[model samples]
Target: MKASPTRVHHAPARALLAATLLSLSAGCTGASPDAEARPQASCAYVIEYDSRTYLGREETDVPVGESLGSATRPACDDTPGDGDDGEGRALMTAFAVKGVDPAVAIAVAEDPGAYRLVVADTVTELPPELRKVTDGS
Candidate 1:
């Protein structure tokens, strides 16, 4: 026996309704609105491939979309203050970069590389003075 058009439509509608109910039920499990909406912290770091040297680092709480141009800020403090691990603070690495825009980090990452900073997302070019560190000199 074949399913009637009405039966098919009803089946699909019921499936959709079930899915919607499941989602609604999940949301009703009781998490605070703020907790659910809050962005988690992330880690950010820079890789240099050229003769770039940083004396220090500093962080500015700029809006996520602001163009982070060539402004040299002091490096973060030796005592860990932000984020996890407490490997000490290092400005850019101090904050949770979870919600940070990629363009912003990309702009910030370019300050050190004369040739390139990150190539293909997996490998970042080593700093020029860091040749000995990579055996690429």
Candidate 2:
């Protein structure tokens, strides 16, 4: 008797093709893999006084009756107060920056007076007083 030829299996090949097609279709959805990792601009407030600026990540972080200048360290320096006491609470400005990198935002927050210029172009809208702080007025 002649030896029978082995039959090739098509199931695994079909499954692999299906998986490849599925993955290709999923990738065609126009969503970037790093979209979630990208940095998004958010509402950040800045307090300007004596030609210096302090950044507050949240509005509540820098209330209108606290002083950020009293803190000896930068991390604790975002009180956002208001008064004529000549501290960092002289002026409070709220603004949003669009398309700003998270690292740049942090740099601005750490030292607004120095890093404000880095994101000057990305500032969305600003009050007249904020203009002074950005413009070094």
The most accurate candidate by TM-score is 1
TM-score of each: 0.23, 0.20
- Per-residue accuracy of model 2 over 1-137 as CA lDDT, tens digit each: 75557867789999999999999998766467675454343324444433444344322221122222321212223222322222233322222333332222222233443222222324455445444434432
Superposition error at 31 for model 1 (Å): 3.7
RMSD after CA superposition, every candidate: 13.8, 17.3
On lDDT, the leading prediction is 2
Tens digit of per-residue lDDT, candidate 1, span 1-137: 88776754568889999999999999866477565344344333333222243221233222223333342323333334434343342233211122332322322332322112221133255344333322452
lDDT of each: 0.36, 0.37
- The stretch of ten residues in a row with the least summed lDDT in candidate 1 is 111-120
